[model samples]
Target: MVSPLTVVKSEGPKLVPFFKATCVYFVLWLPSSNPTWFSALIKCLPIFCLCLFLLAHGLGFLQTHPSATRIFVGLIFSAVGDAFLIWQDQGYFVHGLLMFAVTHMFYASAFGMKPLDLRKGLVIAVLSGSSYALLYPCLSGAFTYLVGVYVAIISFMGWRALAGLQLIGAAWRWTKLAAGSGALLFILSDMTIALNKFCFPVPHSRAIIMSTYYAAQMLITLSAVESREPVEAYGLSKTN
Candidate 1:
């Protein structure tokens, strides 16, 4: 039988998606107005609040589940990236790119840590390498160094994920899959944004990128919680 506290705690994870959705709405609604310099400062309050909420809630979840720390860190980087994008200072793009690259690397590590064979590392390498190769051609000299560094990080992350797969315990497979899927979504979100920025320059790029990013982060948090809680509780009960 489940305890009352467990029931209440479970609700916390459910709230993550709604809070993330609210943040997405605020990000979209505000930039449309094109606020004055001073007005833009004021306009930032809502988005700022959203980031704070996500950061706080994410950290709270991470405290009990260390395995999810990478995902939480990714959320932090993504929030920073979003802030840079909103600021619209051309100098900030590199910073945003770096932050997002870190975010993807974190997810790759998280996915690689799943309970699969080490040979699966080759698959991850192929996937990440193919992605970088396709995207690299479109990146300009302005971002050449940054992209090169980011590509290296991505490759390392893929290798890390593959290496970690050998360490995943049997009972943790489901949890790992849930967490890995969330990480995969984050990779997709970042890839889409990079494509939009360097290659296509789509109209609703901002909304589309942010929507996937936020969803991926929140799902990741929930996945961590789900994966850890069951294992911890089950272990405790068995030991008792």
Candidate 2:
């Protein structure tokens, strides 16, 4: 069988698609005011490219890392959410939010649950609770509960990410760090969206949100690739 390092080296250059897709979104789609089909396609390109990059490893990748397939699902949902959000003026806000909520759930599943690290849970609870308090006055109607659920789901995702990763060595440490940072960045991007939408306008929010979000997804994807070499660190033997 081929080694993990060989796979990574062979796949590294395939990242070109991911970069080009990201560049297209930030440059051509983000600046445009019009919400056309073309713009929607551009918006979801990065995630689609991410999925492609993962699929490049073939189905065998799943055996290498238990979360590989779930991560792919999460990326797909993220892409859908991105496209739906582009039509927010047409009342697709709830759809977008729901899609992303599902996305987070898949991500949490990918992270798995074990050790039940209450410390991480407590920190996430505080952050989520504080964020909810700040956004409380702004939430109303169906969103009152809707946003609350979304916050809870994302918080759980964050906690799972923090608790799930382990830094046993240099390679494992980088993978763990990337996954953890991705989770935090995901939360930060959402916070920026919440502040800009439900509260006062955030300066440069559009760029901040999209940039952080892309960075978050990219980091998470890379972590999965990095984890393949040492699947033992991920505690897959316990689950599978």
Candidate 3:
């Protein structure tokens, strides 16, 4: 025997737009009611909304498809981490990093690094590595290993993406640039969060960093979706 609630759950995929709108509204309304409690919920809601949004887009419900499964996975893990951090759950932090690492690897694969020139890859690597080195000292002892793995994976991904942009040229330059910038910010935000959690405590830095990080991700993905070239332009011979 199933209740109406179960039925609604079963039908959720069909009503994605409505669900997204409601989630957006609810999160927006949270700040006034109970700031602390709702803020936590708002942190978690983005993950839920992102997952649903990606699923809906993949299923052809959305107007454009960015094929950003990798990036979305990063967001999902980040949101989960944010939820855990908000509640001060250290156990889930490792899980979040593991998920984020996988996301970075996927993004690296999407960048398709094989064709990139060595000079460009070297330049990108140097830039990313320098940035990571600057922040490495600030991470918590417990999170250091996980952060190391994350830094390696995401840095490589960023390098590959940058190389891809350079090699591929302006065909989709803005889109890739947006994604690269988003990835960089995402890394910074996570490092700041770890610092706050286990090393130095800061006030409200978590929220501010995360807000910017999440916004960067959304913009990157939107740019990617808008930058896709038409398949027909490949100019294959028209066979009867």
Candidate 4:
């Protein structure tokens, strides 16, 4: 039997380069704090590389489970959201938020197909409800309703992820854990974005948000690739 760490290690060739690129982009891009054509182009590279990483893993699993395709689609939308958010001054903030909202819907659907854990669902509801309540007052004008809708969808996504943790088989335990944790991290990153944009400024907010976001995406991608059963029908051995 292969350990989860071994499974992850097998994909290191594809993942390592992108991880290095992400780290490089963060080091160079965040501290500069000024958006120019060059900076925007550089900023987009990390997001694009991360998307490629997810897609590589997602496609590897697609032959085994159709749900893997959904994960790929979700990552694509996340990349789009990253692009829009990178260019906030070009009237893309709302578009970025909408893209992420759609991305969470895909994630929710992927996780919701399995049996749900009621206790986790209740916890998500309470946390999301209280967060919205607190942030709603801070947002003004049209953003209040728009951000509210985003909050609801992301909460549902997180809930479904938690529910998925209860449904995985023993072989897939680590995958589910990684995915569920990724979902929670995704929510945390978004909450930081919301607070930074609406309520108050967070010190080193960009670094915090982007680091968490990248980590979440990478973990989810790993889950998608690692959870599927070995494709014997495709002449692939379990060891493969």
Most accurate candidate by lDDT: 2
Q: What are the lDDT scores of the predictions, listed in order?
A: 0.57, 0.84, 0.57, 0.76
lDDT of 4: 0.76
Off by over 4 Å in 3: 1-41, 51-66, 72-77, 114-117, 131-142, 166-172, 223-240
Q: Residue 239 of candidate 1: its Cα lDDT?
A: 50
Scored by TM-score, the top model is 2
Q: Decide which is better by lDDT, 3 or 4.
A: 4
**What lDDT score goes with residue 118 in model 3?**
79
Per-residue CA lDDT of model 1 for 1-240, tens digit only, reads 334377457645556545755555655566533534443433334334434444555665555554466665666676666666555554567877777787767666545443445565677667777887888889888665676677667555545433433224554343344445555665666677778877777677767765666555555554444433433632433353
* Model 4 CA deviation exceeding 4 Å by range: 30-33, 36-38, 54-60, 166-172, 227-240
The segments of candidate 1 whose C-alpha lies over 4 angstroms from its true place after superposition are: 1-9, 12-17, 20-28, 32-64, 104-116, 151-174, 227-240
Which of the two, 2 or 4, has more lDDT? 2
lDDT for 62 in candidate 1 is 54
Provide the lDDT at 174 for model 3.
Answer: 52
Candidate 3: tens digits of C-alpha lDDT, residues 1-240: 233466346544544553564457455654422336566666566556655655654554222323355555556666665555454453455666666676667656545554566786677678666756765677556566666666677777767666645424345455566566766676667656656655577677746565666655554443344324333334532469
What's the CA RMSD of model 2 in angstroms?
4.4
CA lDDT, candidate 4, residue 18: 70
Q: Which stretches of candidate 2 lie above 4 Å from their native place?
A: 1-11, 30-32, 166-172, 226-240
